[model samples]
Target chain A: MSDLLERLRGRGWRLTAQRRVIAEVLDGEHVHYTADEVHALAVARLPEISRASVYNTLGELVALGEVLEVTTEGGRAKRYDPNAHRPHQHLVCSGCGTMRDVHLVTDPMGALPEGERFGFTVSGVTVTYYGRCPECGSRA
Target chain B: MSDLLERLRGRGWRLTAQRRVIAEVLDGEHVHYTADEVHALAVARLPEISRASVYNTLGELVALGEVLEVTTEGGRAKRYDPNAHRPHQHLVCSGCGTMRDVHLVTDPMGALPEGERFGFTVSGVTVTYYGRCPECGSRA
Candidate 1:
């Protein structure tokens, strides 16, 4: 968290209380929260924080490469993940909206042959799979 | 196009002129267009088509499992591809916004081990790779 704060300060961002609270809310492992969710959490710490500030802070974090934006189907509100420097995919629970990170050492992009690439330079690939978790499956 | 219309009719969708124009606009190989782009082309054929109807028709077609909705980075408008029944990923041209289909027989979900799966039942995976096209690379 301190490292993130230092990086933000190095980038000339104002170290305001709202930004600090947002950064703290985003810290820790396996945390992915939508802007509204983040706002709700941030409000618990800093009551004066506005939704627009939370949105702006999240957008700025994404632009600074400190966060990632996950957009799912149905045009759901985009979720923010602070673990941007890592290479991982998400396993989203279909029944409960729980998300977990899955890391793979193998390069999935290498599986696509040059002939099949259709002249486009392949850069990166993201894979997301949705299904009910064990709890949800048991309930079903 | 006739087959598509027949299949849609079999699904009990109304055979309106606007729907016909939208279907025609989506015809041909390697076509991926947003709703507005589809609407623009549909209007060229049928001048009275409304944007709302285009959105409505696209949503319905997606719901019917006849079209794929692509949401990528750069806030590019969602693009629809008529080739929904086929299993494929996308190789998108960063320079021109062109998209081509790439098929890989390997299961993407298999890439993640059971330990990494986190108890979520993974249903499907969508992969999109961004890169400069041949023409764009040559220009550069």
Candidate 2:
């Protein structure tokens, strides 16, 4: 994802070894890693990367919309989903917390009628599908 | 929500002062409170309940399907939505984190095609509509 790094440079993001490593770890399709996972992976690549740095880098990426934060469960670690080239939703395995990206053919925004808008400038909608994954379902 | 308590009792949930107070706090329609908010309100009523009790009670409620834990935003404190008699989705305020209940006219499960089920038995779907509420929008 060097192109991502290059795009960041255009946004005036200060390039650092840790930020670059974190970005590299998060690069790729359907790559969803939690903060701790990102930190552990980055630490493996760079021995000196700090936890705070990883958090900061992730925060910056999310703020810039280069990364999407997906919280599928209650009060649990948030999984960072690499924003793919297109808009998508998440299907999560309730048994093991596994998540996959799925693009719904139906637009969810239309589901909310105008009467339900509640007068707030609507930003968008987030839908999470919960179910048992194949492995989890079979195990039971 | 005496019916909730009665159901819990039928399910063999031990009735404690703390659990009862927490249940009372959450015993209404459109009730969504964070852990801290629940604690504050419970203390106002019962004065001696610990934060741990609040947490433990909430956790037990969710585990029993007596309550629904809602994490609308990534990495933010989870808000507990008291499950109304009828199931509904949430409309959240992006600015103040205020949430309201809304029923969708369309069936969300139908939105997902058979191709996307991915061999998992689908359980349910949660939709969170976000925007500025009237107060927040007016202030801006």
Candidate 3:
């Protein structure tokens, strides 16, 4: 994750200790953590990282395109995906709120017809598929 | 919209004045309001409906599947679409936060191939297309 830090540093990001730890906690593949989760993880490392600092760092990372902020349906907490470089969709478990990153061979933007454009300059699309995870499905 | 209230009434919903006003505010076609917005409109009519009551009413409507709660990116306030009887997607204005109910010719759930199911028993899908509304687009 130092590679990401170096790149961000090269882009003029002031790498404070809290921001560094947040980057570390969110570095792995298929990892999506809410701000609370990030704060909890960051606290484990720095022990003095404030909640506001974590939130600010995460916001900065997202604004710099270093992380992607993913908002799922119905629930309040927004999750962060480190895989901003990847063009992918998300599958969220309705029961447990577990998120999995998945890619499709087909693009979803083509699903909207030209007639349905409704005069709004369309930019991008987010497709979230809801389901139950293996553990959650079995109990149901 | 009385059709919805009657259906709910037939289902034995205890139709309180607060719930009834909330239903009335959300009854029209292509209507989606955040809880605060719902409370604002409901208060204009009832003048004394509490914010908690508005939230509770909206929550019950979602639990009953009488309304659909849509959460888009970067927006903390979730909007409610009462047109839940028919299947549709959403196109949201990133600039002004305006939401429009739209139907697509293709079903988004069909886009996910079986191989990428990732051990989740998939249930449904929601697609939110982001863009600027006409006024916002023109401004830009």
Query: What stretches of model 2 exceed 4 Å from their correct place?
Result: A138-140, B138-140
Largest DockQ belongs to which candidate? Answer: 3
Q: Indicate which candidate wins on TM-score.
A: 3
Task: Evaluate all candidate structures by whole-model CA lDDT and list the values in order.
Answer: 0.83, 0.86, 0.89
Give candidate 1's iRMS in Å, 1 decimal.
Answer: 1.9
CAPRI tier of model 2: medium
Candidate 1 local lDDT, residue A34: 84
Clashes of 2: 0
lDDT of 3 by residue, B20-114 (tens): 89999997877989999999999999998999999898999999999999899988888899998899999999888888888888888888898
What is the overall TM-score of model 2 with all chains considered together?
0.93
Which rank order by DockQ, best down to worst?
3, 2, 1
Q: Could you tell me which 10 consecutive residues in candidate 1 chain A have the lowest summed lDDT?
A: A70-79
Q: Is the docking of candidate 3 incorrect, acceptable, medium or high quality?
A: high
Separate DockQ for every predicted complex: 0.57, 0.78, 0.85
Candidate 1 lDDT tens digits, A31-121? 9898999999999999989999998989899888899988654445678888888788877776777788888656788768878987666
How many residue pairs clash (N, CA or C atoms closer than 3 angstroms) in each of the candidate models, in the order given?
0, 0, 0
* Candidate 1 lDDT by residue in tens digits, B1-140: 67989988987878999899999999987889988899999999999999999999999988888888887665448899888767888888767788888887576767888788776667766777778888888444
Which of the two, 2 or 3, has more DockQ? 3
**Model 3 DockQ vs. reference:** 0.85
Error of 1 at A57 (Å): 2.0
